[model samples]
Target: MNVAHFEGAGAPPRKRPWTAPGALVVRALGNAAAAAPVEGAMLRFGRGRPGDPGKPVDVTVGVDDTKVSRQHGLLVHRSGWWHLSNTGRLPIEVGNHVLQPNGDAVPLRAGVTSALISTADRRHLVELCVNGSEGASPAPAFGLHTAPGHVWRLDERERLVLAVLGQEYLRNNPRAQPLARHQAAAQLAELRPGEDWDVRKMDRVVEAVRLRLSGQGVFGLVQSDLPQPIGNLLSHNLLTELAVTTSSLTSADLMRLEGAD
Candidate 1:
């Protein structure tokens, strides 16, 4: 059952499928050939050894890329899948998509996905491969935490809209990029072919989402806040205190939204 987050709306939380992978292989793509198995669920990448051994990041890059940060990025292991989150000084680009510093992560799809870490100091190319993930794919789940005691859940449409915008924000200009808004409208249109959609309509939906957040006593999303919550979202950076990032997207959510399931 779909529970709208309009007024007083909620449903029980869902537990998505979580599968453990056999291993993650990271390869340095340069001069010769070198490979390593990411030890645990979390891997941290960078040039030198981590200053603090207690830090939980799991991967390290042994390359000539001096520009790479000690804590460049991370491949965090979730319940069922692995997601790439940028934690470095530079952006992490994967599959032609770029993630800003501390930007939203992308789920690891099948096959090898390489990310380019570009910096004036050093440029490095690394590829990630998920070896032998075993289990049934889980349903996609979206959620939000507005206030300390309040929570909001996104319906399929809302989830899809935010996801499209989030990814677009990462791909283009986070601040001035119009791709997110325009592309989101296109995505929403694909979801509901019976209705007509324009940029203005999509704006209305976004405004409505903000209103819902404000109505729930969340102050950061309404009117004009210094951080500009909507602007940040438009840039694909999630309101960690309020919304979930695109990395949380599930195959089931995609299928149902596209009417594929």
Candidate 2:
């Protein structure tokens, strides 16, 4: 069971496969009292029905329903165990995968659980053997590729957030040229909902970009709120000199002449 965010209300539906290579088959015991009925559906990765003669249940993951953030994939296992894996820059613990067994909903193992590991054997998924320019053969269960080209269009807020990333880049590298106007604008459009894209976050985010580019930059709101981890993510996301410069600055800063104190 892959946790995919589907825009079910006719919003460019992602193609669903009958079966995927790494898809996990899960068993749902019962509904959680705390859990509300949510939208978005789970599809098996490969090509067969989950013919477990238990519960014909559904598992879902998305912003509107599960509130699972930043995780690339989620699987509720056959033994009623849940596993969340990172698609981006974070990881979910094994304890975080526990289902609500017995009493009020509780995490699995109560913090004694192991880390989330792939159950797939070497056959289901194989690393590509790169043989010079000729490349290698495809693996048996090729999964949904989240390539950059697969990016859904960015909304206005997301674009602004992206712009903030650009601004951070510009603040540190004063000599760099500006970002492509259209590119910056498009990125701002793709903000995840309710993101403020505020100044303090923007400042450190900018500094984070600088640090990644030159291996050094600023952090924190006044050195106190300096978020080292988030800064690192920002750095990884914004590497180019142009992405660094414009993503770091605000409109107010932009109004001032470059190098003006």
Best-matching candidate per TM-score:
1
Q: CA lDDT of each candidate?
A: 0.51, 0.29
Model 2 scores a TM of 0.19
Single out the weakest 10-residue window by summed lDDT for candidate 2: 28-37
What is the C-alpha lDDT profile of model 2 across 128-230, one tens digit per residue? 1111122222223457666442222334433344444445443544223335444443333334324543455555545543444444332221223222223
Local error of candidate 2 at residue 38 (angstroms): 9.4
**Model 1: which ten-residue window has the lowest total lDDT?**
1-10
Candidate 2 lDDT at 190 equals 38
Per-residue accuracy of model 1 over 52-71 as CA lDDT, tens digit each: 56442234453466667777
Candidate 2 achieves a global lDDT of 0.29
Clashes of each: 6, 41
Off by over 4 Å in 1: 1-22, 29-40, 49-62, 132-261
TM-score of each: 0.40, 0.19
Predicted structure 1, TM vs. truth: 0.40
Global local distance difference test of model 1: 0.51
Q: After superposition on all CA atoms, how large is the RMSD of candidate 1?
A: 16.9
